[model samples]
Target: MTSFRLHKAAALVVVIIALAIGSTAPVTARDSSSTSKHVAKRIALMTSQKAAMDMLTGMAAGRSTFDRSQARAARKQLIRSTGSIRKHFRKPHLDPRSNAQPLIWHAWKDFKARAGTAEAAAKDLNTGSLSGLRRTLPGLMQSCLSCHETYRSTPNSFTTH
Candidate 1:
């Protein structure tokens, strides 16, 4: 297989692994100050997602040079981060530092499905060509938008779905 094919296969495997990880219960460390740890994880997850989106959108829009290796790495990281979303968001009211709404835990099933959709879209993204990237971007963004609309809050207030 070509490098593109190999990367595609690797992305699929990563998505599958992520789904498995997200479906299982998270093993959290319950220390006296676990709230701070959860807040940190939330920050890390947001940063990872932002970085991944910047890379992907940059490549798609011709703003960044397309690098298959970098794409593969970003895709893998995104899958891992999405896997952590369920685990990280489990503890509600853990921190005032996040824009994550309490609605997340209330609508857990919908949130998990959205994460799964993003993982599957990441797996399906064919960065082999600009056209392929364009084709895949919408699916990925739609998944993100759906989750953000339903579960996340803005700086001012929580968004109602």
Candidate 2:
């Protein structure tokens, strides 16, 4: 495979692993009950975004056939989910179930900006063709990774039940 293809493959694997870990990881009792609802909402939002991303990534990685309508639907879902990220994280609610770093609250503006970038990338995604998806999906994935690397705590860093 070409270097670019290898890079894309690596990114796809990272995203898949993240989603897997996030989905199955149990919640601990490290946080207060008051913030649990907020954290749950945040997790649900992220889960939805991950579901959409999984579909696009599958098509991009040639693991699944690309249907233009399905790709477009995923693109729309991403656009909506990314657009809501700032609102979802506006509160500094930390829960044991959350992988969010405290730095997110401290670096609020930067986090919002990163979310905006992801939203823009989602909106720019071209689902009209598989080629378009292959070309543009990396930008969206990169935007997500850029924010996640800085704002999300690894599952291993926190204790889980």
Candidate 3:
């Protein structure tokens, strides 16, 4: 009878210890699936931006014909993408491979302001004439450069400033 009681007490103690350890175990609060989706969205948005910019650059450099319709389409895409770009940068979705710096969330207001400026520049681009586009190109380029200088971190880059 005494042996039975001793064994029961030892089992109870072991169970209690296990419960305590289990309760204290680190839980992953982050939704990795959601994070991955956000990362993918961000990547797609950036890729689209690059594609649109490449088209613009090709026209500016005279490597491609200055098609007004194409320029307008690219400009419109840029304007639309600005909204998606903002959406994908939500604070909770951090990806290690992303070139987005933490400063984007830290200075979200400034980031949004830059995004707004970029959108406005895209809207302001004049696709009617080569000279008109040349005039507006600097503003669009500056908007891109300004954001990249502050918020983007390139692979192998030592600095974000």
Give the alpha-carbon lDDT of every model.
0.65, 0.76, 0.69
Q: Rank by lDDT, descending?
A: 2, 3, 1
Pairs clashing within candidate 1? none
Q: How many residue pairs clash in each candidate?
A: 0, 0, 0
* Candidate 3: residue 46 lDDT (0-100): 59
Flag the better candidate by lDDT, 1 or 2: 2
lDDT of 1 at 124: 74
Specify the poorest-scoring 10-residue window by lDDT in model 1: 23-32
lDDT of 1 by residue, 1-161 (tens): 23354345434433443455564523322222566455555655655576687888899888988887787777777777666677767777554345677877888888788888888877777767778777987787777777777777763221211
lDDT for model 3 = 0.69
Q: Give model 2's clash tally.
A: 0
RMSD (Cα, Å) of model 3: 18.4
The C-alpha stretches of model 3 lying farther than 4 A from their native spots are: 1-32, 155-161
**For residue 131, what is the lDDT in candidate 1?**
83
